[model samples]
Target: MRFAISIPQFYADGEFDPAAFRAYFARAEALGCYESAWAQEMTLSASPQLSPLEAMTYAAACTSTLRLGCVVFVTTLHSPVHLAKSLATLDQLSGGRLEVGVGTGGPQRPFAAFGVDRSRYLARFTEGLALTKALWTRDSVTFDGEFWQLKDARMEPKPAQKPYPRLWFGASGDGALRRAVRLGDGFFGAGSSSTAAFAAQVSVVREALAAAGRPAAEFPIAKRIYIGIDSDAARARQRVNAALAGIYGRRVPAIEEAAVAGTVADCVAAARAVAAAGAELILFTPLYEVPEHAGQIAAEIIPQLG
Candidate 1:
């Protein structure tokens, strides 16, 4: 199993220290402990978080070998053309070390706040995905869809990765999992999901791939896991629950239960369960004490995982 880490995004106003951030990536890359670094996007949330793309761009500049990505952009809320252009630029800027993750952002999201019609958001998401791929792969695109239209529109300096960077779909539902099999290069399970939930999603993904005649080896499956390592399991659990509550704007018992906490052994057991759930690439996200979490995971956790 491959291991990844989350790029910290929860910094308050004037709290971001560029030097510290650079050191984090540099150390991570130097140790070769992480294969990729990911960010999460949550716009209009009560918590303070950086924009995923911007955070990713900063990360790209800090580490040469570590692939940078956003776990899932709420694509339904974005303009397809603009999103495509931005990703293509980021791919070039990162020297092709870019992974794109997109999703519908769920039913609870305030779609109207983003000027999206709740009923048609799914159509917008599907069509937008198609448009983005066309822009990345073709010299010029011409298309007429229910939500958008383009005529001989050209996007220059196509993504640094030939045929575009890997597109990962963030999905939990069976229908969405099947769609990922047809449209995305990989399936990414949410950090908020439990190991059991992720396992069920993986089963659906595998079944969908088999039905589509797609090779399982070609489609990577991954999950982002919220983790905290502390000698006192109770303290770790308390801290994790508090941090997640702050980030999610409410306390969720399921998410708290899903998080990995406690001593190194405890974390290892949790991560092992996730691996058994079918995460080819597991993104270990430490919610609090980000720097210390990185060091501990690199020195203690990664060695045990293999």
Candidate 2:
């Protein structure tokens, strides 16, 4: 089973320790077991989080072999041209060690803040994705769409990887999962989703791929698992719930329930269940004590899971 870890992004005011951040990546890279590191995007949140792109850029500078990615950049809220250029530049900077995940977030996002039409967000997402792909693959692109229009535009040098980087889709519903099969390179189950739910989602994805005549091996499946490990069971659960609250900016019991918190054995069992659920790549996300979690995952947890 391939493993991935969350990049530390939580920082309040002057709390971002540059040396510690670099050291974290250094240690993670030395572990040599992780497939990649990913950051979450929360452009409008009470949480004091670093922007995913900036966090990823800093991480790329710190590590050599480790790949970098962001999960589910809400494409509807972005200007496709600018977003495409930035990602293409990052891919070049990172020597093509970049994975791009996109999603049309729920309808309740503050669309007005980003000048997105709430009623037409789905169209915006698909069109923007298509435009981004065109910009990445085409030397000169001419496109006429409802939201974006480009006439004979050139995105320089292209990405180091042919046909752009892998596009992973964060989706929940059946229609959206099918859409992911149609457009995205893979499916990424959310951290908020329970293992059973992820299993169900995996079934849907497999059916869609079968219907489309796509090989399951060509489409990778991954999930972010919120995990808290400690000898003190109650303390672990409490810390996990509090961290989830901070991440979501609200008390969400269901999301909190999705987290795995307890002893090392408990975590190993939980991770095994997730693997059984069909996650080829399991991204362990600890909302607190980033470095500690990475160490434990690499040393204590992953070894047992295997």
Q: Write the per-residue lDDT of candidate 1 for residues 236-296, one digit (tens) a residue.
A: 9999999999999999999898888899999998898999989999999999999889889
Worst 10 residues of 2 by lDDT: 297-306
- Cα RMSD (Å) per model? 0.7, 0.7
TM per prediction: 0.99, 0.99
For all candidates in order, the CA lDDT equals 0.93, 0.93
* Residue 7 CA displacement from its true place in model 2, Å: 0.5
Q: What C-alpha lDDT does candidate 1 achieve relative to the native structure?
A: 0.93
Alpha-carbon error at 130 in model 2, in Å?
A: 0.5
TM-score, cand. 2 vs. native: 0.99
Q: What C-alpha lDDT, on a 0 to 100 scale, does residue 278 get in candidate 2?
A: 99
